[model samples]
Target: MNSLRAILLGTLAAGLSAGGALADGVVNIYTYRQPALIQPVLDAFTKETGINTEVLFLDKGLEERILAEGQNSPADVIMTVDIARLTSAKAKGITQPLNDETVNKNISAEYRDPDGHWFGLTKRARVIYASKDRVKDTSITYADLADPKWKGKICMRSGQHDYNLGLFGSAIAHWGPEKTEEWMKGLKDNLAHKPDGGDRPQAKSIAAGECDIAIGNTYYVGLMRTNEKEPEEKEWGNAINVLFPTFENGLTHVNISGAALAKDAPHKEDAIKLIQFLSSDEAQRIYAEKNFEYPVENGLEPSEMVKSFGELKADTLPLADIASHRKEASEMVDRVGLDDGPST
Candidate 1:
C-alpha cells in the first residue's frame, strides 16, 4: 500500500511540475490592439479552458513597454500585428523561441519565424482598393500605385505606419533600395492627400469621392462590411472593390498579428499551452471568423466577406525580409515625405 501511494504521489508531482494546473492561476496577455479586437478571442479561450485570461491592451508603444518591463513583466504572451512589430519584439529579446510542431504545421512557413519564436494567427493582404466608378481597369498592380496616372488620385496611410513600412520593406526586398526608393518617390508625388490615418480613412475617402485608388488592406473592408454599425460605413464599403495585383509573378502583400511566449514568463508551460491553443486550427478559424481576418492555417477561409473578394495569390515573400529592410524603408519614407501617418 505504501508503494502504490508513493507512485501516485510521484505522478501528481510530475503533473504539478509541468504546470498542469493547481499552481497556474492566470495568463496575462499584452496586446498592441485595443481590447475590442482581442477580447472575443480571450473570452473564447477562457470559456474553453476555464482558465482566467487577462489582457493589457494598448494602441501604441507596446513593444517598448515589453522591453521596458524586461524580466519583471507580468506578461505571458505578446500579441502584435505586422511583421515589423513581430520582428522588433523578437529582436529586443522580449520573447523566446517557441518551436512546437503544432504551431509549425498550422501557421504557414512564410508567416512564421524559422526558429519558431513567433506564429501568426491571421492574415491581412496589402491589396489595392479602387473606387468602383473611377478605376475602370482591372489589371493594375501594386507598382501602379506609384504611377503618374494615379497622381492626386491615390489614397494611402503614412509611410511610417507599420503596414506601409511592411509594404515598403516587401517592396525593397523584391526591388532593392535604389529602385524601391525611386518607386516611392513617384508614389509619394502621386498621393491625393498626405498619408495619414489607418486604412479605414483611405476607404472613407473612396466613399466620400476623395480619391480613385487606395492602397489598403482587404480585411479592413471585411471588418466594415460585417460589423459596421453605421449606414455610412456600409456606403464606405460599397464604394470600393478589391484587386489582387501582381499575381502573375508575386502574390499580394501580406502581414499578420502574431504571438510569442514571454522569455521569463512566471507560468512558462501554461504560456506555451495558450500559444499552442491560439495557433491551433480550431482557434485560428474561430479567430478569423470573429475578427474578419484570414486564417494563416492551411485550407481555411476567412468570413464570407473575405471569400467574396474572391481567390487571391498571396505575396510569397518571407515576413523576415519586411522587417529587415525597415531602416531603408524609413529613409525612403522620409525622402518621399509621404503621408506623415494619419491626419498629416
Candidate 2:
C-alpha cells in the first residue's frame, strides 16, 4: 500500500516552526481515540525506543485542526477509531501516504489503505447482545434482526452513527442497495423502541427487559463487565451474553481502530518507527488486551474474555467498499426514520 513519498523536507522548506530547533526524539500525535485506550501502546513505544510520544486527544475536528495549522501543524501522526473517520482524514487531505514496508507487510490488504494513507491497528466485531433470560437462541445472524419473530424485541442505537453506518454499509456491500434498503426497513419495523442511545445503553435496555436483544460492538460488553466506577453496569454485562452475529453467508461484521501519518510531520522517521512498532506482535498484544479488541494482524488472538464471546468468522466484504456506501446508508436511515422506531 505504499506510494511515491511526499516531499520529506517540505515543511522545513516552508519555514515552518519559525527557526526554532525541532524537538529531538519526539512524535506529536493528534488522536480521536480515547486516551486510556491508547496509552499503553504509546508508553510501550517510548519505553522501547527512548522517543517521547506527545498525544493531543481530540473528541472531534482532528483533520480540521491539522488543516487549519497547515505547514506549522505539529501533528506527526493521527490516530482514530472506525474506518469512516480514518477515510475521512484521507479524503480531507490531512494525511500523507506511508511507505513503510513493516506497515504494508503487517496490515492486511483489506484493512490498510490501498494508497497507504492509513493502517488499521485493531478490530471490533458488531455483535448481538442477547438477554440470557428472554432470548434462548444460542446462535443468531444479522439477517435475523429483521425477522418478524424479533419484532418489538430488538434494540439499537441511532442508525446515523458511524458504528451502525459501518454495519449498514456491510449489508449494502453484501446484498446491494435495493435489498439492503429493504433489510433496513425490516430492521426498523422490528425495533423495540426508538433508537436513542449508545451501544452500551442498548445492553442496559436489555437488562431492564426493555428488549430481548440489542446491537452493539463486542468490546463494550467487556468494558461494562470491568467498569469499577459504574458497578451497576456489570449487571448489564452479566444479564446478556455476547453473540457474534453472522451474515446469512456465515460471516460477522467488524470495524477498526486505525492511524495515518500526518502530511507535514516534523519527525517523519520517528513517526514511521512508531507506526511500525505498533504493528509488531508485542505492541499489538498490549493494544488488543487492554481494549478487548481483536488484533488486526492475522494469527494474533484477542483477550481471553473477548475470546470467551466466541470466535468470529469476519465478513471479508472489503471495508473500502463498505465505506464508499456510508453516505447512502445514512440517507437510508433518515429516509426510513429508523431512529423513530418501528412504524405500526
Candidate 3:
C-alpha cells in the first residue's frame, strides 16, 4: 500500500528525483486502468530504460475524453479494458498503428489487429462461479446460465461494465444480433441481483449468501484472494468454485485489457517503446503473476490464483467479433431491464 501510494504520488506530481528527468524519455499515458494494476510493467520499464512515466488513471469514458482532446491531448499512449475501448479508438481514428515486428510477433493474431493497430498484453476470461452447496450439475455454457432454474440465483456486475459487454459481443458473434439479444434478455431475467459493484463484489455478495452464483472474470477472484485488508476475502475465496464452460459445442468467451498508441502522439517513439516493453517476455510474466491473468504469449503458467480457481479452456473465437457487436450487446442490457440491486 505504501509503495503504491508513493508511485501514485510521484506520477501525479511528475516528481522525478533530480537526475531522472534529464533522460531521453518521457511517456505520457492515458490509462483507464487502476494505478496498482499497471504499476509493475510501468516501474520495470522505468528501471530498465530510465524513462520518466506519467499516467492519468481514469476508470470510465477514456475514449470520449481522448477524442475531445484531439491533437491537444498530451497523451502518448492510451490503455484500456476490452475490445470495445480499443475498437472504438481504432474506429474513431484516435489510435496510431504500431508497425513494430517485436509486438506483431509476440501478440497473437486473435488478440490483435493484423494491421498492427493495437496489441493485447494480458487476457481475462468471463466464466461461471457457483456456490458449491447451491448449484448442482453446473451448466455447460454461458447459454446455460440463462436456464430457468438459475433464475433469481445469479450475481453479476453491472451490464455497463466492459467485461459484460465483451461477453455479449461474443454471443452476438456466434448467434447473430437477434439471437444474442434474446439470450441477453433471458440472462437479465435470470439475474439474481441488480447490477452493482465490480465482479469481486458480486462474488462477495454470493459468499455472503445473497446469491448462489456469479459471472465474472477469473482475475477478480485472484485479486480478492490476495487482498490483505479484507479477511472476509478468505471466505469469499472459499465460498464458490470455478466452472469453465467447455461443453464440446463452443469455446468460452474471454476479453483483454490492452494498450494502443495515440493517433497524434507527442512522444511517439516512447509510446511504442512502452508497448513493446509490455509485450516482452519478462514484462508479460510480471503482468501474469502480479495481475493474476493469462499472458498473451504461449507457455507461461497462469497466475497461481487462476490455477487455484481451476483450469479451463479459453474461447478461441477471434476477438474482433467482440468489437463488431459491442453496441447490440449493450442495448440488450438496457432492453432486458436487468438493473436490480446487487443481491435482489
Q: What's the true lDDT of residue 267 in model 3?
A: 80
lDDT per model vs. reference: 0.77, 0.86, 0.76
User: Which predicted model would earn the best TM-score?
Assistant: 2
Question: Mind giving the per-residue lDDT tens digits that candidate 2 earns over 1-344?
Answer: 01111332243224333333257688887888788889999999999999888777778777776776777677898989999998999999999999788888888888888888999889999999999998889888888887999999999999999999999999988888898888889999989889988989999999999999999999998999999899999999989998888887898999999889999898999999999998888888899889989998758988898888888887777778889999999999999899889897
Model 2 clash count equals: 0
- For each candidate, C-alpha RMSD in Å? 8.4, 5.5, 5.5
Candidate 1's C-alpha runs over 4 A off are 1-23, 340-344
Q: lDDT for model 3, on a 0 to 1 scale?
A: 0.76
Query: Which numbered prediction scores highest in lDDT against the true structure?
Result: 2
| Local accuracy of candidate 3 as per-residue lDDT tens digits, 1-344 | 45554454454346434333223478877888887888888999999888777777777766766666656566688888778878888888888888898888778788887677788888887888778777776554877777777778888888878788888778777778887777666777777767788888877888877888888888877777777888788678667787776433456777888889989777888888999998888888787788888886646677666788666667777788677777877777777676654233
Model 1: per-residue Cα lDDT over 1-344, one tens digit each: 45554554354345233443224666777788766777777777778777766666667776666565555566688888888878888888888998898878777788888877788898888888888887888767778876788778888887888888888898888888888888887887778777777888888998888888888888888877755578777777778988877633757778888898877776777787788888877788777777777888547766777888767777778897678899888888887666542222
Error of 2 at 211 (Å): 0.3
Report how far residue 225 has shifted in candidate 3, in Å.
1.3
